[model samples]
Target: SADYQKILKDGGFVISMSGKGNCYDNAMVETVFKTLKAEIIWRTIFLSRLEAEIAIGRYIDGFYNPVRRHSALGYRSPCDFEAAA
Candidate 1:
């Protein structure tokens, strides 16, 4: 628990997996994964796992990180949010 305490003291943010008893804790993350699965992974049949990897990599590096507007970040793309900071 020392590392957890140190992280808390340093104001470091960490994501934790939901405990089996705590459904609410993973709700948002689960929702996002549901969206990802529904919209991207489940929608198409790829020739191989490598193709899926490339598609997701490109989605994150080329589109999602730099261009997609996130409502939680005041509707700014992650790159825009970091640039302002």
Candidate 2:
């Protein structure tokens, strides 16, 4: 929409949209969401919105970024990959 484009432009942000039916355009993000759903969201029950937010934050910061191995990074965690780079 023109409004959305205007908002993005006004905010000094670049907008990139995938074409309709283009699964490969956002494959990495889709994979991450799928993994998060399977590994964390599906396994835990949250009592409140805050609890869920904290849990997801911990999962990404404490485990995923620092400890979890990723196949794309030669089985290294993101932190390790960054360190090597």
Candidate 1's error at 76, in angstroms?
0.5
Model 2: per-residue lDDT, tens digit, 3-85?
A: 98999999999899978999998998998899899999999999999999999999999998999999999999999999999
lDDT of each: 0.80, 0.95
Candidate 1: give the clashing pairs: none
RMSD of each: 4.5, 1.7
Candidate 1 C-alpha lDDT tens digits along 1-85: 7788678768965645555789788776776677667867888788999999998888778877798887878999889999999
Off by over 4 Å in 2: 7-14
**How many pairs collide in each candidate, listed in order?**
0, 0
Question: Residue 36 in model 2: shift from native, Å?
Answer: 0.8
Top of the candidates by TM-score:
2
